[model samples]
Structure formats: C-alpha cells, structure tokens
Target: MEDLWQAFVNVDSAGNITGDYSGKNIVAEDPYDFFFLVDKEVALSLHEYKVHLDGFKPSLVPKQSAE
Candidate 1:
C-alpha cells in the first residue's frame, strides 16, 4: 500500500485562496488534472496545495514483544 497527504484550495466569495501560501507545492502526478479553477475578474487565484506524511497516523499493530 501507498501513503498520501492531501489538501484543497479553500475559496472565499471572490474565490481566492482563503489562507496564506505558506505550505503548498505542486505535484507532477497528473499534468492535466484540474487542481485549481477561478472565475473572471482576476480577483481569485487558485493555489497549489500539498502535505507531508512521515507514516501512518497510528500503527495497525502494537510493538512486537520480545521473542
């Protein structure tokens, strides 16, 4: 199995990214994917979002006991 992290562009009335771009990165998994979209007026801009995953949130199994 593969692990993954995810994020989405949070938009406001104007459709701009609601939060700062402090943590966002572009992924090359799929080029033609619609990662972002904005309406006219130029008031809104899509943001590339990303996340990091060191490992599963919690191990499925507990630490093995000494054999």
Candidate 2:
C-alpha cells in the first residue's frame, strides 16, 4: 500500500494553470478535497496541516548493499 501521493501545479506569467496526475490532465474546475488523516480519527485540509515533511532535508546515510 502506498502512503503518499503528490501533485504539482504550474502556472506561467500569463496566469495559465496546468497540472497532471498519473499522465492525466488536471482540471481546475473540479472540486478538490485536500485533507489529512491523523490517528485514523482527525482530519485536516492541505492548508490546515501542521507539519510539512516535504521541506525537510533528507539524511545522508548510504544504502546497505545486500550482495
């Protein structure tokens, strides 16, 4: 099971919005429900979430080879 999914939106200087998910076009007129699930109970929108993991830097640990 995948725990995370992401979508990126792009807009040019002309204010043209563009995005795609899984190779399909993103529709701006569609109703988008961005939310967060906590402890299998609470819920929050994309803006309401407290912690943003994406901004954090990754660890420099080297991968262990199984060979």
For candidate 1, write residues 1-67 as lDDT tens digits. 3222223333443333444221134353433212322222111222332222236331111112111
Off by over 4 Å in 2: 1-4, 22-67
RMSD of 1: 16.8
Candidate 2 local Cα displacement, residue 9, angstroms: 2.1
Q: Which candidate has the highest lDDT of all? A: 1
CA error at residue 42 for candidate 2, angstroms: 19
In model 2, residue pairs whose N, Cα or C atoms come closer than 3 Å (at least 3 residues apart or on different chains), thus clashing, are: none
**Against the hidden reference, what TM-scores do the models get?**
0.21, 0.18
The collision pairs in model 1 are none
lDDT of 2: 0.26
Candidate 1: where are CA atoms >4 Å away?
Answer: 1-7, 20-67
**Alpha carbon lDDT of residue 58, candidate 1?**
16
